[model samples]
Structures are given as C-alpha cells and as structure tokens.
Target: MSLTSNKSSSVLSYLESVSTSDLISDPASIGLTIRELLRRFGGASETTSLTLQDLELAFGKSIALGFSLWQHMAALDRLSAIPDWLANNAPRVANLRNGSAICGLATTHLSSPVTIHGSPSPNGYVVSGTARWVSGFNFFDNLILGFETSDAYCFALIPFPQPIIPIGSSPDSIRCDFRLLDLTALQSTSTGELTLENFPVLNTQLLSRREKNARPAPRKSSLKIPELGVAKSVSKKINSALAAKQTHPLSTDFASALAQINSRITQLEAERCDDSLDLAGPCHLLIQDTLRLFALLSGSRSLAAGSEASRLTLEAMLFDVFLQSENSMRLKIEAAAR
Candidate 1:
C-alpha cells in the first residue's frame, strides 16, 4: 500500500504543512502524531504491556518518532517502578504520562558522559548542569534526564517551562536556557542544547531504581515500537512513491523492501507475546534496510537537503539511541549498524 493510503487527511495535512525549512527550526509536528496515538492507545497504564502489533496499529493509524518515545516511557511506567528510596513525592512526577515527557537518555551530544550534580539542600537537591540531545521540549512538558553519576545510572524528572533560578543564592524557581542546534533530521522535533545553572530538583522529582544488579534467568528484549512505527510510516511513503513510478528500474527493489517490511511486521505481530527475544532484531534490520532502500529508490529526489526522505535517513542512523541502557536491544542495533 502507498503511504498516502495509510494516512488520513489530517495526518497528510499536518505532514504537508511542514517543509524542509520548517523542520530546520522545530519538529514539533511529532506532537500531533503523539497526541493521536495516545488517544488511540486508549491512554496506557502501568499494566499496559504493549507489543509491536499495538504499535503498528497505532503507527499505521497515525505516524511519528515520538510514538516510540511515548511507547517506551509508557512501557517503563508499566514495567519498572520508581524505587521507593529514590522516588519523589511530587504529584506531577507521577503524572508525567499526561505531558509525554521526552527521555534525554543517551541523546547524541550528551552521549559523552553527562551528569547533573545534586547539591544537598533543606528542600531538596539543587541540580545544576548542562544537558544536550534534548528533543520535543517545545511540546513535551518535562525532561526525563538520565545521567551517569558516581556509580549507577541516575534519572530525574524536571518539569518543563521551568523558571530560571537566580545566580547567587537559592531562588524561588529553577530556570533552563535553550540553545537549539541545527541537525540533519527530525529538526521539527524541536531538539536543542540545554544549559542548566543551579536548576532545583525536589527530592520528589528524583527517579530511583531498586535493582540488585543481577542477570535475569529468562532475559528477553522488547521492541521499540516508536522507532519501528516511524520506520513503518517512512517505508509506506517510499512504497507509494515507488508505486507511482513503476517504470523505474528501482521499483523492483522497492517492492522487495516493502514485502520484507510487511513480513517483519506480520512476524512481530504473531511472536511478540512469546518469551523469545528474536522478534525486535529482524524487525529493526528490516527497518534499517527499508530506510536505505528508501534513500536509494528515491535517488536524487531524496538528496534534497530538507526532504522527508533525507530526514528519515538521518533518523534511521539514530535508531539505536534513547533506549534504556541495560536493554539488550541496543546490542542488536549496534550489530545492524555494523
């Protein structure tokens, strides 16, 4: 099926309104996709264990990279509990789902060890540090900053649209400055370089884990549905474009790629409920290959600096990032990259 057929008018309208220039400044377009998916997913709960099929249905229903971010966080909400010792008492921290906060873990620029120091204070810990690789901040209401401290991976939830903390003594509010950077893709995501100077984090905002640091007897990897969903949408668009130009020799390759994506989606749908970890690997490989073929079949047309195809090519390269650190799936992404 052509990507056009898979999308509704509203989705198309939103996509059409964005140009390369628009993406260059902000990619908040993804918020629309996220909002639609949340509504369709019926607002996930701590118990909602979403599979690839659910993501496919949601992606096929709408579209976005935020979908994976939302899905992963939702899954974390469902699967992992904020350790009682490290848990914050803020009501908003527990309600992060309502704002669809962007997880800043492993973001590219911050991929180089990043940490926010916690200065002990009477009210809470005053965290002050700069963090980059932040996306969807313009739309997402909070920043899920994951940092490497002394021993373990520490994560925190900071409310968005934060007020600036004064330079000298502790002030009434914490402030963050944004220096948006230009990127190859997902520019519309509103990604930026964040500078935090004495940003206050209440104890209730700290996200703690209660893991014993041991291997599981039955380990299995879960799929990053949002990544796959973005890949799915891009693949359909490539399919539609290829279908329109049947006379092109690359059409055959396009057909083959589309078939492979479909096959992978079908397999994921059937096997996701099982305990085996084999499903996400092949699915990512398929999406990776699908993006490559999209660039190939689209050829010179895709070379345009701000084209959607170009953005997707960059997104495909970044597919491996932003996932949980201990996740075994990252290894597969590494292998696929190789």
Candidate 2:
C-alpha cells in the first residue's frame, strides 16, 4: 500500500477527519497515523534516498499535533520527523498480520532468520526466535524481523496473536512481558525486549525486495537522529529557562559550551548530504560531544543527593540527547574509519 498513491488521498482525508486534538494523548490515534504512514510510504526503493527536509517537516508537524492536543508544549519542538508515526504503529501492526515497516538502516542485519536453523514447519518455514530491540513491536500484528544469514540480511514477517515462545530475557533483547520502561525520558513511548525460543515465522511472511536504486534505504539513525536533534534543541531551551533566574558560573559555562557545540552541529547538519558518510561523520561527533555536555550540565545540579538541584538534574537530562548522539557517533566513526 503505497502511501504516496492515489488511494492515499482518501486515507489522508480519513486521517484529517481524526481531530488533531484527539491524537496527542490517544495511543490508538497515534497508532492509526503510523499505519497510514506505512501504507503510504513503507516500501520505497531499497536504495532510494530520503528527503531530509520532508522528514523534518513530518516530524515537526506530528509533534506539534500530538503536543497541541495533549498540551505537552514542552515536547512539541523536539520532533525531527515521522518517528512518532513509526513508533505509534507498533501496536496496530501487532493486529495486522500482513504489513510491517522493515525499511530502514538499522535493520541491515536482517539477511536471515534470527536463529541459526530458522524454525521449520510442516507447512512452511517457521522462525521461532525473537528479534531483539524491535521498536513498535507491540503494535505490529505481524513482525518482519531481519537476521544475518550466510548470504544477505533476509527479513520475514511472522503472524501474531499467537502464543508466546518462552525464553530467558536478556538486556539487549525485547522481553515478552511488554512492560514499559520506567524511564523518565520517553515515558510515553513503550520499548522493551523479546525472548523467543521458537516464535513461528511462516514462509509466506518474508519481505520481498523492491527495485534497486542508487542509494540504500533509510536507516534507524535516519528515523531517530532528527528527532533527537529536535529534542536537543528543546532541552537547550529548557535549560536556558531554568538558568534564567538562577545565576551560577557552571550554568553560564554550560550555556556557552552548548552554544558553541550547537554552532558546530549546525554547520555539520548544513553540510550533511545523502549517503555522504564523510560529512555526516563530524555531525555525529558533534552530537556526541553535545550530549555529553548536556548530560554533564543536567547532572551538574545532582552534585549532591540531598540538594535542591538534584531534582533539577533529573528534569534537565533528556535521554534522547545521549542515545541518538552515541548511535550517530558510532556511525560517523565507522564511516570515517572505513
């Protein structure tokens, strides 16, 4: 279901009928939007390039719509693009056995089934292993998990609403419990690990390759970093507000440092182009340093456990800042070294 197709005109109208006010707090509404997005844009050419500008616009608009309805104005500016839609559709996908958003960069390992043997079934191949760190898995009615095969990263979708394949849970994987993280940041988004012993994946569930193009498909960083960038900008604004009345040398220094790093970040962002790993390398590094600085600045108040500043530190530390920066940094380093 190509979202950019004429069929999307009606879908878009249906989506428009959904009051923007209802989308913010309503996980269901968010889920619907995600489904629409996938239906519209999911299976682009594997080697197609992404429109960074479009991504940024989609992200900002989604955030604005969600925040306006929920009155979470603080977070409104943190959205870089359509990640909210991507994450939102997880639950819905758990209901729809046919569709899955397997198009992205972080999913390169999906050359084969998650397990070595790839579960066998009398009818077709049944993949009975869990794919770790599957974001938006909760909403997916079926899952198209990627695995490292002998040849390529093969991806397959497994039907859902089935019994769980029990296994011991690990830190890096998704747990079957569906327990939301008690994370102060991204509390609204549900993420966890899965433990699959033999989660059945039928042969018909495999993701088919589309037309090859000049560029590779978008990756997780493509989905996450822009959002993180928005989040970082928001955090800076919040910190400025918090430090407005209270004067401290550390606060001033942090502000100055943040400004300086952000300036570099801005330059790098401007220079970033499609698949140009060299230009993106410095941007990723800048994000890492900026995150560290933000973390340090946010934790500055936590110098003492009992101090009034401790709470401030918690409020200041935006998780998106560190997580995306680290991921981006690794990519940059890898690209540079390569």
Candidate 3:
C-alpha cells in the first residue's frame, strides 16, 4: 500500500512521542519502532516511493531510525530478487515481515578492496575475511553477506550469533566475531566490524550468484530516497530558521537554494530514473550545502554536542561514506571542487 498523507503523519507522530536522545541511547527502541511500523504499514514488498517519502519525513524526526529502517528495507529489496529462496523460506520471511527477526546487509566488500573469499564446500561454502562495515549489530538476527569466489560473486544469508555446526563438522567450521565501532554519528545504529573465519554457509542460505565481471542489474532511483530525505530535512530546518529572521542578510540566498534543491529532488523522484551516477553527486552536494547553511544559522550552538544541528552535521558526514562507489566518490569530488 502507498504511504498516504495520513500514514506519513502517523509515522511522524509516533516518532515524535519518543525523544531523540532516548532513541539514540537505546538501539532496541529503534528496533521496536520498526516492528511497530511493519505491523502497521506492512512489509518491505509494500515499500513504495510514498513509503520512502514517509522515511524522508522520518529523517527530520530521527536520522538514526531513518537510516536503520532504510537498511532493513534495502535488505528486503535485495532478498526479493531471489524468488527461489523466498519460496522455500516462508516462515523466515514472515518473521522478517513481522519484525520478529531483523536483518542487516554486509555488501560493502563488493566495492572495497577488502575481500571475503568463499571456498566451495560439501554443504555450501566457507567464507573467511572481514566485512568492513555492518550496521545493526546487536539488533540483527541475520546478515546477508556478499563474498567473492574464484569464478563468481555470491550472496548468502547467514544466521547471526553463529549457528551451531552440523554433526561431524569440524570444530572450526563456524567462527564469527563482531567488534562494535565507535562512530561519531549514528552510534545508535551499533555499526561494527564483522570478522568471519571458516564460517560455513549452507546451500539453503545461498541467494544469488553472478559472474564476477557480469553486468550489474539496472540501478533503482529508490536508492537516492534516503539521501533526499536527509537533504529535505536540512532544508526544512534552514527554511524555518530563515522564516524566524526574515531580514537576515543571507535569507533570500538560502531560500533560493532550498527551493532549487527541493525542486531537483522532486523532479528526480518523479522521473524515477535508473541512473544513480547522475544523481549521486548532485544529491550529496545539495545535502552538504544545506547542512552547512543550517550550521551557519545555528552559530555556536551547532558546535555543542548532542545539539540537533551538531547531530545532523555529523550524520551527513557519515552519509558521505555510506555505500560509496568509485564513480560516486569521483563525482562527489568533482562537485565539491566546483
């Protein structure tokens, strides 16, 4: 179902009921909020542009929660590509839908030099290497990991907490360790470094396997939704501040910039184009500009820890690194240099 105006307002109201500080201090609270949302709004399959627009609305309320929800929904989207797996895992899918189980994506290795190699085994494959960044550590019950083998790139769903090995399996069959990273922002996400040594992935858990050099699937514009949400949130705050002090020297300039950025975001959303490369740099640049404007408007108050301005500034910095691709990185550099 589409996330109608009433549903978006409902989500915002529910988020408003909890203080941001309290939500950040307790990651489980974010999980509960997601569960409540799933129970009310339905599952990832139901996530449309309106659903994402609701998340964009969420960014103004809580960045951490918005980011976490995006991660969950993205994971669901990836899983949907593997129809055979979904057909066989009905109960697991139900748990995911109902929020009885939470899943995180660990596919940054696909773009990074860090390699999680999978060696073929009788059961499936043994994966060993470090997955550089995995959010939702303590809160996730499963992880969808991407790894490289000799001939292909593979995706697999592995149980978190390291499931027990089957009888007759070697003692070192499955070993996984999680090290929580101390992040400057989004600490509530519990992002961490995941180390896997001789971790076995059963055949049933295997999702998609593609040739290492195979052409990637068409890009989706939905990927930009979260970033747009963040940009919109920053713009709204700046506009609110400008409204309060209409005579401020930079008010008109900032207003114009916000209008242009909002117009661009709306245009992109309406097009729903499959060209992320063309969108990434402009989106990042707009967000960066709005963040700086907000900081300027807040003055010294934005520098203070736990301040909303400070929180958003740091969160925007974190997004700069989130799912960075070589092309996106180059585009951002080009945009910044302009």
Candidate 4:
C-alpha cells in the first residue's frame, strides 16, 4: 500500500503509538513485502542452513523498505531532511537487509537488563539506559531485554523508544553503545554496551527468562530452521534466473560456479545435520560460499562505481563484508559444533 500524500505526516501518524498487536501481529507479511520491494531496488537474498539469515532477510527487508520509503519521503520534500545522525546510520540499516544471511545470530541467545526510571510508578520498563547501534531501533516496537538477576541472565521483551542514542553519537554513562569494529558492512548494527544507574525494570515488562548458562531454547531453534528455507528459495531463484538470461559463453561458467557452491553448501549442511561433520567448519564454509556466489554474480562489474548495476553489486559486497567477521564466524562454528 502506498503511504499517505504527506508521507512524513503519514508515517508519524502511523507510528505515533503502536499497539503490540499492530507491531507484532503481521511480522511475516510485513517482512515478505519488504523483501520484494527491496529486491526491486537491487537487493538479493542467500541462504545457509541457518535461521538468522531468514530473520535478517525478512525483518531486515522491512526495515530497509521503511528506510527507503523514508528516503522517498525526504526526496519528495514531504518529510524534513533526515538529521545527520540518521543519515550516518543508513549504511548500517541497508547492510542489514543484505546481511539476511546472518541476522539475529548475534543477540538471539542473550538478554540484557534495562533500568527504566521515568513516568507512572514503574508502569513500564522505564529505560533510562540506552541501546547502542540498535539496527532499526527507530522502527522496532519491542526489544527483548536481558539482565542479570540472582546471578543469571534474565531476558524480557520491552518496548523501544524513539530519539535513540546511536553508538558513536556521543558517550554517556547511562547510554549503551554498540561496538562498531565488530560489524562489517552493517556499520550501524554493531554490538555496543549499555550503562544505566538506578534504571527501573518492572515485572510486567519483562519479555523472557534466560537461566544462567542455559542452552538456547529448542523451540526457537526449530522455528528458525524453516525460515532459512525462504532465503534459500529466493537466492536459488535469482541465481537461476540470472543464469537463464546468459548470452555469453561465460554465463554458463557463472551458472556452474553458483551450482557448485550451492552443491557444496548443501553437502556440508547434510553432514552438519547428520552429526558427521562439525558445524563450525560448515558455517565458515557457508560464508565462503556466499561470498563466492556474490563474486560470480557481480564479476568485474562489482568494482565499478556510479551506476545502478554498481550499486546493486555494492549492496552484495557490503553484505558479504558484514558476514565475514571473525567473531561471528566463531559463534556459528561453536554453535554448529555443539
């Protein structure tokens, strides 16, 4: 659906107060529509035998669409120009859409404590503390917060507020900042620190419970597995479509390369599931295969600048960069080995 004539006005009207029902109810549809829209704007999807890729591509697509829509609004001179801070954060968000190959993997297993200290007597999680480099925080309605309680990490789903304190904006004692160096292309989605003094958290606002040193929930894991299928379908379709349009002799090579990568990745996945091979190694292999596909699809054209095709290639490049982090690779490896 098209936004209102006064897009900025409409967006504000749309988001002024979000009910949990409005925000969480249609996450799946919202994400899909976003993926299609971004695909129109030169984004591609890839899959690994991992769930975070699905979550990233899906949710990340919506956020990217929202941001793109915002840019359109700004271009129409409907919304005021984005502030410098917001502009600075756009690269991070865009990369998030491309990095669907590894979204949510970073924070899925942990929870943080938020101390809220404002308004009606502990009515909600009065978050005086800040979340650093929160991707799409401006649009996220609820955040799964974690805190240490009785020597355990307890997680709760809390509503996120606007006017967020972005990482690298400025340093503050009560603010949480994401570490930027850890992220590759998603410059904005870094994992930062949160600091709060006497922040109040209420019982009702809590989202989930993380028992100290407890393994991740199996239900969540199972749910994520299916989501990866969506990305796999999308990537396979795009690569095959690109393969079919080939007029050059080299096009077959590209097809062969993509097919080879996909074949190897699938074999690795099978081994991972059968407990015959370590997941850590396969996860690394997945990243490598994804990068290889990106290279094949973009070819020498990926190096050019100032053209529409170049922009598309750049998005994929940034995506691979974001996925290539050593720490992230390590986590996937560890999770797989487990």
TM-score for each of the candidates: 0.63, 0.48, 0.87, 0.46
The sequence of per-residue lDDT tens digits that candidate 3 reaches over residues 255-338 is 887788778768766655655336655666667777887888888999998888888877776657774556668878777698
Global Cα RMSD, each model: 6.6, 11.0, 3.5, 14.3
Angstrom error at residue 295, model 1: 3.1
lDDT of 2 at 65: 26
Candidate 4, residue 98: CA error in Å? 24
**Whole-model lDDT values for every prediction:** 0.53, 0.40, 0.74, 0.38
In the range 67-149, model 2's lDDT, one tens digit per residue, is 11121111111122235433554453332211233211113243333442243456544333443443333343434454443
lDDT of 1 by residue, 257-309 (tens): 68877787667656666764444455566676777777787778789986667
Better by lDDT, candidate 3 or 2 = 3
Give the higher-lDDT candidate: 1 or 4: 1
Q: Rank the candidates by TM-score, best first.
A: 3, 1, 2, 4
Q: Residue 123 of candidate 2: its Cα lDDT?
A: 55
Clashes within 3 Å, all models in order = 11, 34, 0, 26
> Candidate 2, residue 60: CA error in Å?
7.9
Model 4 Cα lDDT, one tens digit per residue, 1-338? 33322332333333333332222224343333333333433233212121323333332222223322222222212111224423454553344333321122112233343332232234543344434324432333334454555434544434443233554544332343433234332223322344443345576644445566787543312221222222243356448657666775577776776677677657654654543233443444444455445545656764665332333333334323332345556765676598
Model 1 has an lDDT value of 0.53
